[model samples]
Target: MNTHFSLFRLPETFELDNQILEQRYRTLAAQFHPDKFAAASGFEQKQAVMMTATLNEAHRVLRDVIERAAYLLKLNNIDADSPEHTHFEPEFLMQQMAWRETLMDAKLENNAAALTELAQTINQAQTELHRNLQVAFSENHLEKAAELVRQGRFLQKLQQEIHAV
Candidate 1:
């Protein structure tokens, strides 16, 4: 499979300029739009459809940090997505429990304000994870990057729960 970064002519890195990715995605989408190939042979139209879908998927993966991190891990032959199989550090695991307790407590108390504040704190933690992932990737520390990717995933899910509350 062609890498997502190569589709957008980007380097495989944790940090990307999302604005530029969106612009390039638009250009690629327009170029491969099925309408543009409507008058062409059936094969050509099919090709256009496939290309458009690929571009859409690539854009979706590249624009999100968590997805991008997973993609990077995949490229390195690492699996970070399966919570049941891939174990996180004990400290992080303990912290995850604490975060969940805090979130549950806020919900039990019916404190939207506390939930919102907790969400903000989780967002900050996610930002830090992203930053650390960049350093890990830059140093070719794929294992560390994969661990951070898992942490980010947990934080993202926790934040979603907070918002749901």
Candidate 2:
């Protein structure tokens, strides 16, 4: 029942780095996927099902940019929960808000050109932010990376909302 990342240890053959994490995910999934246990006894099948779910959840949280940032902060004993001031500049937030508002208004007006531009802008921002995140993580700047992740998560949500509209 422990949700702590430390409790999610890799197999001895695996490691905590990104590549090993993915490898472990695949290995566990191959063994624990429901399809792989279909002919097992009821108890064995249930265990496989639970293991599969846990493996998927672990992979999801570990692989995601935002979640990985938060996890890294926790590992370093930083207060990553301070979303208000972790990594983003005010100007960046302001620009994001303006873009979101534009997207909202454009959706209402059914402006194809506006939508296209907005999409491109968002994509470009994402690319830059991803690079920033990589640099921050590599340099052990969890605070900075956390900020980029926060912005990315917000932009992703905004993109989904716009698409839904």
TM-score to true structure, per model: 0.90, 0.74
| Candidate 2: residue 113 Cα off by (Å) | 2.4
Q: Cα lDDT of all candidates, in order?
A: 0.89, 0.72
lDDT of 2: 0.72
List the RMSD of every prediction in angstroms: 1.8, 4.4
Give the top-scoring candidate (TM-score).
1
What range of 10 consecutive residues in model 1 has the weakest lDDT sum?
Answer: 79-88
- Top candidate, metric lDDT: 1
* lDDT (C-alpha) at residue 7 in model 2: 34
lDDT of 2 by residue, 19-101 (tens): 86777677768867898878899999999888888878778878776676666666567655665655568898799789988
Clash total of candidate 1 = 0
Clashing pairs in 2: none
In model 2, the worst 10-residue window by lDDT is 7-16
Per-residue lDDT of 3 in model 2? 48
